[model samples]
Target: MLGLRILVHSIKLVVRNWRVALRISSPLIAVLLVFGVFMRGSIAGVATLGPDEGVSWLAIGVYLIAQTFSGTWVAVAWHRYVLQEDDSGAIIPSFMGRRVGAYFMQGVLIAIIVGIVTVVAAAALFFAFSGLNSLVLAIVLPLVIALVGLWLFYRVSPALPAVAIEEALSIGDAWRATRPYSGSILVLVIAMAAASGVFGALVELTVESSTYLYLVLVMVQTWISMMVGISVLTTIYGVVVENRDF
Candidate 1:
């Protein structure tokens, strides 16, 4: 019940401060728009050359690098603004340097660790259940793996806010800080996922079949979701780690 309250409070916080959310997200929106308009054609051209082609690989690399930097910038900015009450806007000139790189590297490190663990667990399950029905294994195993991944992610998520504030936090520190609130974190994660899924379904059902329109709607949905996620995590971090009142 406490977890639910925190989730509700987080949602209210984001909705109540919509202007701040928009200002913080504006830089990301602008960057995405520019990339879509200027680089999409070139990337698409390279993609048409087939997956095995050198130009295709180049395009993928470029896209990934751009996404990593842009995503890190947005996440760090949101964390700083919401968690620290830093009034600095989305495009803080000073944040574009080492701070952005540190944030990006931290994310990459966490992702790599989570990916490895998930892969290893799935492989173990496959071998251990060699005699299980193939269809059941195929469907159930992936869901189980996904749940485990989500659990692991929540365990270390506190480190992300730590990085945002330039704090020296290890994975162990984050894991332990969140241990007391694990139940609440689980509820929040599941609730957020369900909400996002429903929102996407509604968009699919009501929107016209125009590619550009769909893309725009999806981007908007993503931004809103991002804001909610940051808010929830920041709130949790403040309450659990810093002993701050909600």
Candidate 2:
């Protein structure tokens, strides 16, 4: 019930603060547009990368780096807007230097932990079912690993919001904060994914099959999805960790 309320509240918050949301999300949307343009060219030329593929690879790498930086900045800005109750600022703040670095490091650490869990689970499954048919093992192992990864991701997701708020939180703290709401968290994740999937499907069914149109729709969907995600996470952190009302 609380999870449902949180999700509803998130949507309401976005609707009520659409202007602020747009400001916070503009940089990310811009970055997505640039990324889509470059990626389209890269994908179109991928088949012809016979001799001089260095420039293409470099462009891809640069896009990845820019995307990462922009993503982190947007996240931090949203966090600030939510936690600090500040609604008047540039879309991207001018002085998120150390904060960005800290958030990036926290992200890296979380990824490492999730990766370790995945590898360990895979190893355990392999050894525990050595006698099983190879085909069964091959099919089941990946599914099991994916499930475990999703669970792990939900477990630590609150940490990102905590990092955004400069909450002096550790992974263990986040894990503990969300432990009681694990089931709610799982439901929230599924609900969000299903909503996004359905929206994307609708867009695909209705829109003409133009690459540029697809990219534009994707970028718009991504921005809205990200804003909702940020709102959800911030709300969850407030309710669970801070014991406050949304």
Candidate 3:
């Protein structure tokens, strides 16, 4: 249950330091809000559709790029604020261009690794399940495949916060560090997936009620998700890498 303990503790880190978390993320939140308006429909499960935010391909592209920058910046800043407790105390977190670039690079590397692993896992699982052809299997197979990916991602995600803190850690290194926590991580992956799916469905029901409310809920969810995600990586890095106790 180490992973569950870590998840709960990580959440407390964000909640206890909620003000600083907001300060670290607020600038990027503003940036995302501005560019987010132009994004239409759901982009990776979070809805961005709005009253006048029509379908613009160019706007979507720009918004995605802006989102990347803003996300990286906030993640790096938050890691520092959590680990280093940086003393600037400014309204917005300090900008670190090189760290942001490095963070993006590491993210792309992780994505590629995760993508390949997921694809291979999918192919294998598809072959394994192909002969069954039951309706229940059809519904459950994708969930199983997705859990595989999430499990793998959690195993190596320590690399992300390492990059944020200017530490060098390869995917292989992170994978090795997390070896003992395999069972816990799998349980954590399942719990996280279930929670996210339930929350996303709850928010999706609001889409037709009021566009503004939908937009607000979606952004708020994204904001909290991002912070909690960063905290998770930070927690993992602290526990397995730095040998810090919660």
Candidate 4:
């Protein structure tokens, strides 16, 4: 089956790219380590909001926006520089500013769309859960949610490479071209996400007030996020390149 083939091919590509990512990420890893060591005490002391606790909505909005922008930058760098396609080597950093800006904007756009979908999905889930005694609704609601989530991802997954290569500003066009490849893309994304989760848990486990532990946690989390972002962009690019119809 096509899905099976995609899965196998993606795994192979991921394996091949793993070493390249490690090499590309070395400088970033070192910087994070140094920064973490210096900032550990302050960062560790900063309290995070607990679940279900109310916080400033404005602050929350700003935080989410920043996260989205950062995620986009990571995605862009992975595709544009890390993989390098047929290029002799990674692109020069002096000219990479434009690429980074474009990717950041794409990330912001995708984040907004994802946010809207998330809100709608949450509201729907709440209503569905409340009315789940109705078998028809129970059976239908989950399918609807899954489809919406899938469609949202399909719309966003290809934007990284599109933005990197063509510098596309139109997210809609990217979505259209990426549709046929959505299923495989999603599988690859989920696999990378799982890998990210494992790395995150490792960081969480070492969290403590001690400066050493705090530094370790921050350094680990940052590079892991970068790795996940890189894996995602590379996987999506490989999927589209290897399977034109995908």
Candidate 5:
């Protein structure tokens, strides 16, 4: 029930803030689509790569930069908007500033931490149960580890909104604050993963029909996933950090 509430509230936050949301997201979404179109070949090639094959570092770097910038820009703006913390009072959100930079850096740090934790957990589980592994276990183990990493990520994500609002929250602070709510956050993560998987399965069902339709659905899903993911983090931050009513 807690997870369901988080999911519903996150969607509502996006819906209620639709005007400012669209205003800030439009230009960045255009940029992302244009970038995707230009990099379509390389992006598509990623899925077809052999075990020994690798993508070009340059292409990967460019794509990551574009995605990270666009994502952080929208997140910072949305956080400020929802918290009533931004005094910019502009029609659209700001793209360049200290807040975005700090958010980006902190994001990178969090990614590193999550990656390290995931790797360590996977390794530990692999070695500890080396002789008991089955085909199903092989497939499930990594997925479980990834989900654990995501749960940990959410537990520490309040620092992001704190950064946006210039509240000086450390990563440790965020983690400690949400310690008791770990189970709730895990529930939220599972619910989100289930929802995304369902949406993706439906989209896959349309892939055989029309390429245009598949592309449109993919873009829409991507946009919704991005916004809701940010909103979830923002909601968690509000409830935990600001003691906002859930």
Candidate 6:
């Protein structure tokens, strides 16, 4: 199947670029691990039941977007730095720190913009569905919004690396370079998201009876989910670097 092929190729690419992949992903993993420790209680609270649960989930969604943007920026910079070991002797961080910094700032800006967009979109949807049955809209709206948001995210996903490695600030350039394999990249993202969702659900199901178990499970699941996302990004970046000279 096509999915199998994607998986196999993704694995191969990761292996081929193991050094670069790990170099990029290791620091990111550490950062996310620390971040999760700090944010676990808050994120877990988002999953609990109440009239405010929907709002809490939406907030968690926005937080996810922010973390994704931050991590993606750093991932790109680290990958670039590793790939440049041949010619520049790993001078990506040294020579391109300013560009990386700019992209980091841009990532923050993108996170804020995404947060605002999510909030506005949620508000509009909430109002629009005011007359609809809560049960139906609850299921439908979240999926619809998540899919749309992910698509939009995929559109600008490569911008960080474009800025970090290529020194290009314009998102337009990133889109162009990423265009050739957008479909594949999006597939990977969706698969990773679905897998993480399933894993989280399983964890929640297993830990439902005990608060301590729930907290532990949630923290572990969150870390694994994030690691998987970063791993996929690392694989994609490796492919990109191999195919293009960047």
Query: Which structure among the candidates has the greatest lDDT?
Result: 3
Tens digits of per-residue lDDT, candidate 1, 1-246, equal 766777788788778977776776676666556545554432333223433222356665665566566667767877787777787543332355677788777777888999999999989988898799999798988777887787778778878888888888887888898898888777776776678779878666533565456546656675677667777767877887788886
Per-residue accuracy of model 3 over 156-181 as CA lDDT, tens digit each:
98888888888888989999999988
Q: List the lowest-lDDT window of 10 residues for candidate 5.
A: 44-53
Residues 1-246 of candidate 5 have per-residue lDDT tens digits of 776788899999879877767776765676557644655433322222411124475765565567667888888888887886563656556775899999989998999998898899989988887777597468877788879999989999999999988898999999999998898999999999899889888877875786456656666776788889989998999888888887
lDDT of each: 0.71, 0.74, 0.80, 0.55, 0.79, 0.55
Error of 4 at 138 (Å): 17
Q: List the residue pairs that clash in candidate 5.
A: none
On TM-score, the stronger of 3 and 5 is: 3
Error of 2 at 58 (Å): 3.7
RMSD (Cα, Å) for all candidates, in order, is 4.1, 4.3, 2.7, 6.1, 3.2, 6.7
Give the per-residue lDDT digits (tens) of candidate 4, residues 118-148. Answer: 7788686867587566775666665556556
Better of 5 and 6 by TM-score: 5
Question: Any runs in candidate 4 off by more than 4 Å, and if so which?
Answer: 1-23, 41-75, 86-95, 132-151, 167-169, 189-193, 208-211, 241-246
Clashing pairs in 3: none
Error of 1 at 77 (Å): 1.7
Instruction: For each of the candidates, give the backbone clash count.
Output: 0, 0, 0, 1, 0, 0
Q: lDDT tens digits, residues 122-213, model 6?
A: 78987888889888688988876776566455545556555556644355554565667767656665675677678767878854486556
Clashing pairs in 6: none
RMSD (CA, angstroms), candidate 5: 3.2
Which is the better candidate, 2 or 4, if ranked by TM-score?
A: 2
Cα lDDT over the full model 5: 0.79
